[model samples]
Target: MNTINTHYRLSHQIQDEAFILSQAAKCNLYLSISQKSIRLAVMDTERNKFVVLEDYELITVFTPMQVAEQLRLIAQENPLLQEQKWNTIRLAISNIHFTLVPETLYDPAHQHDYLRLHSDLNPLQDVVLAYRHNSLEAINIFSLDASTYQALEALFPERQLQFVHQTSTLIRSVLHLAPRTNLRSMYVFVERNYVTLLVVGPSGLEFCNIFHYLSPEDFIYYIIFVMQEQKMNPEQETIMVWGDITHDSSLFNILQKYIRQIKLGKKPSDLEYSYKFHDMFEHRYFELYSLHLCE
Candidate 1:
C-alpha cells in the first residue's frame, strides 16, 4: 500500500484563477525525486516565485519502472504543466551514489571512475552519469537511475533537465539565503529515512554528505558525532535544520540537548512566493525553490 501526501492548488486558491498555460510568462518546473517520493513545483518566471506545488510519497515499495510510470501519468494530466515554456527544469537526487571531488583535479572524461568508487551500482546498469559543478573547488559526480532520468527526459523534452545532488541544492539554499552565517555552522536536511549534513566555514563548503538512519537516536548520534569530530564547540556552533521534522519531535529534542544553538532554516531571501505558500512550512521546499537559482 503506497501512501501519497498531496496539497494541490494552494496557489490557484490565492491567485483566484488557475495559472493557465496561455499566459505569456515563462515558468519553471522543479522536481525532487527520491527512492520514496516525488515533489513537483512550478515557478512563474515573470513573478519570480513559485505558484504551484505538490508532493507524493510511496508507502509501498516499487521498482524504478513503476515510479517512472507514475510520474509520467501525473505530468500527462497536470494542467499547470500544459503549455508554458519552461525556463529551467531541475531534478535533485538523494541517492548515496554521489561523491564530491576537487574541480581542478576532475577530468570530465573520468566521471565513471569517481562514480563507481562511491556507488556499488554496476557500471553498465543503463545509468546516465553526470555531475554538477557545485562550486569553484567542489563538483558532485553521481549516477542517475536510467529509467528515472529517461522518464523525466520524455516528460519534458523541450528543455534538458539539470540534475544535481540533493545536498547540493541544500548548499545552494544556504549560500543564497544565509551566506552571512555563523563562522562555523552546520545545515541539516532531514527526510523520512535520510539525512544530509552540510558544514560551511569561512572559506567554502567544509563538508557535505548524506546518511541513512533508522531511528531518532541514530539520527542525533550521527549529527553529534560529526560536530565533535569537526571540533566544533557545541556552545558556540549553530545548527540550522529543515524538512519533514518538527521542533517538538524526538529528533529535535535530542539535537537541542547536545547543540547549544539549534534553529530552523527559512526560505531563501532571494525568491518571493504567493500568499498561497503562507500555509506551507517556510523550509519545506527549500531545495525545490533553490533549484531556480541553481546554475
Candidate 2:
C-alpha cells in the first residue's frame, strides 16, 4: 500500500448542531463523485434541511480506480460514510460520457445503445446505468466505472442506493430554476477538464452537451460555438455558471470578454442549509446540493 499518499484533502466541512449519528436514519445522504472530488451532503429529510456537508478534493488520483481507492480510504475514517442507515442514499457520478434521450423513445433494454451513440463503452470497465427524469420526461443514459460502482454497492449492502449521472441532477436543478420565458437561457457547469452546457427555452431544455477544453482559449471557443449553433446572442443572452470557478479566475474573465451577460449560478433553493453553510460560496457545490432533488 502507498499509505494513501496524502492524496486527498478535505476542502469544506460543516455540520449543523442538530446533526447526530443516531439521527442519520432520518436523513438522506447524498454523494457526488467526480474526476477531481468526492462530496457528500447529509440532508435532514424530516426537517427539509441540510445538516452536514463535506467536500474532499483528490490531488493525485487520475483514474477511476484511483478515485475508488481514495473513496475507500476516506470512508474508513468518515463517520458519516461509516453510518449504515439513512432515510435514503443517492450517488451521482460525474463524467463526459452520457447522453440524454427523450422519455418517449427510451427503452431500458437499449441503455447501452443510447449511450453508445455518443461514446464508446467498455463492458469490462464500465457499467451502463440510466436515470429517469420524470419531471423532464427524459432518460439520462450513462456509465459508471465497474470497480467504483461495485465498491459503492458493497459499502451499503442490502440498502437501496440510487445511482444517477451528475448531469441528471444538474438538469433537474436547472429546469426547476429556469424561468418560463420565451428567451433561451444558457447554463454552464465547469469541472477540471470539461464543461457541461445546458440551454433552457420557454418550454424546457433545448440543448445539453459537454465539451473538453485544455486552455482558457479552448474554453471560450466552446461557449461561443454553442451560442452560435443554438442561435443565441452572445451580446444579449445571459449565461449562468457554477462549479470550480471564481469571479476573478481566468475562466470567468474569458467568459466576460466574449459574453456580455455572465452570472454565477446559485445553490439549489428547494432545500434549506444549515447556518454553518453561510460562509461558503453559494455557487460552489451546485451539483452536490442538487442531489437532494434527485428521485
Candidate 3:
C-alpha cells in the first residue's frame, strides 16, 4: 500500500479549481493493474488525445482486499478522482493468462482454453474469464482474478466501467504503437518477474506471448527460446524494449550478446501530454498509456 512514485501535471494558470474532477466525464479513464502498482491515464474524446495522469507503485505486494482499499485511499487523496462519474476502462496485467486462436478457427465457446492452458501456473477457482478480438492478429482469450476485478469494480460503482482484460496488454499496447513495416521486429516489455514478447512480421503479428522468470538466466533463456522457436534471427531481426528495465540491466546485456539490434521504446506518439511528462522517461509507461488506446 506504499506509493513509491507519484507525478501530477496541472498548469499553474488554471490550477485545480478550473480543471474540475468531473472533467474526467469527457475523458476516457484507463487503469493498468499490476502486483507492484496501478497506473492510470485520461483521454479526452473531444480532443481525441490523452495525458498520463498519475501512477501508484506499491512498496510491497498487497492482497485483493488491500489492493481495493489502497485504490480508495489514493482516490480520496486526489481531487480529480472525487468525480462521481468517469468512463473507466480497467486493464489487468498481473496474474493474467492469455492464448491466441487464429480467427479462422476461433470460437467464442472455446474460451475455457485460456483458463485451461495456465491452470497449473494460475488457478482459476475465482477468476473472471474474458476475450478480445484482434482484427489483424487473432482472438485473445484471457483470465484474471475475479476478486481483483471486483476490487476495481467497487472503486467506480457509479461510473461506466468497461474492462480491457486483454490476455497480453503489453503486447497489445506495443501492437498499436509499433510500426507496421516489412522488417521482422520483436517488442519486449520487461517487468519484475514477467516479460511480454511480441513479434511482428511483414504480414502481421507472427508471435505474441508472455513468460515468467525468476532470474536473468531464465529471462534470456525464454527470449532466446522464442526467437529460436519462431525462427527469428536474433542477429538480424530488431528488438525494442520497454518497462521495468534499462540498457545497463543484466537482461539487456545478455540480449545484446545474441541480438544485434536493440531499441528503447517510447510513449505512443499519438497521445498528447502536458509539459510535466517531458521530464519522465519516454519508455516507462507504454502499457499504462496504451490503456487509453485499448479497444
Candidate 4:
C-alpha cells in the first residue's frame, strides 16, 4: 500500500467559521468557507489521491484552546503514515457576516436570514455575526449610504447593530459569473408557462428578461427583438429550455414551429446533480444543453 501526507492551513479566524482546504501535499488545497461551516480536503501528491478531513462547525462560545484540542484529536485519529509526512499546521482567523431578522428573534423560521442578507443589495441593511473563516476575524456589516442607513434605522430603531462590508470569495465568484459578451443569447422556458432570457458568452450569464403571462407569439417576438438589438441573427442561434411541460399543447407546438433548435439543459456530473430551487429552470436547461453539445 502507498501512503501520502497532507497538511492543513487555516486563516481568517473567527468565533464561528466554516471552510475546507484540501490537496495539501503539493502546496495546493481546495478551500471552501461559509458562515455556517468549513471544509478542507487533503490530496496525495504522487497518485492524485484526495480526501476531505475537515468539516467542522463553530459556535459563539468556541475558544482557541477548544479549537486546538479539536485539531490535536484529528491528528491523532488520522495518524500520518510513514511514507506520507505531515507538518507545520497553519491556521488563520477571519470574520463573516450573516443577516439577522429582528422580527424572528433568532428563531428557526428565520434560518434563511443569512441567505437573504447576502442577496440584498441595500447597503443600509445591517447584520450581526463575526464569522472567522481562517485566521482573520472582523465584524460583518452592511455599508450603506446615509439615506439608506437612515431608512433602515427607522425600521428597526432599537435592534442591536453590527456592520461589515461583503468580502467573501464565494460572493466574488458569483459576481464573476455575471454575463459577458460572447454568445449572443440564451433563453429558458419553464414548463411552457414562463420564459427567461439570458445573455451569455465568455463573460458569464446575465438575466435579460423574465416573462410570464405573455402569449407564445409575443414571447417569440420579444426574443427576436432582443436578438436584433444585440446585433445578432436569430435564425443562426438556438434556444434552450427545461422543465415539465409535457402537457402544454400550444406552447410546445409554437416552440417547434418558430425556434431554430430547442434543447433541454442537464445537470453536470461534476456539480453533484444538486439543483437550487430558484435556479431549477436555468440550470436544468443549461445542463441538458451542455450535455448534448459535448456529445
Error of 3 at 169 (Å): 3.7
Residues 26-111, model 3: lDDT tens digits:
76667767666766666666666665466776655456545555666667686555665665555555654666766777767766
Clashing pairs in 1: 3-59
Badly placed stretches (over 4 Å) of model 3 are 1-19, 62-66, 79-82, 104-110, 120-125, 166-168
Order of candidates by TM-score, top first? 2, 1, 3, 4
Alpha carbon lDDT of residue 185, candidate 3?
A: 76
- In model 4, where do residues sit more than 4 Å from their true spots? 1-182, 191-193, 273-295
In candidate 2, clashing pairs total: 0
Indicate the worst ten consecutive residues by lDDT in candidate 1. Answer: 7-16
Q: In terms of TM-score, which candidate is stronger, 1 or 2?
A: 2
- Residue range with the least summed lDDT across 10 consecutive positions in model 2: 1-10
Q: Is candidate 1 or candidate 3 better by lDDT?
A: 1
Assess every candidate by TM-score. 0.88, 0.97, 0.82, 0.32
Task: Give the lDDT of residue 41 in candidate 1.
Answer: 77
CA lDDT for candidate 4: 0.37
lDDT of 2 by residue, 1-295 (tens): 4665557999889999878899988999999998799999999988899889999999978899888888888998898888898889999999988998989999899999989889889989999998998887888999999879988987888798899998989999999898898789999999987899999998898899889999999999999999999999999988999999998899999999999988888899878889998898889999989998888
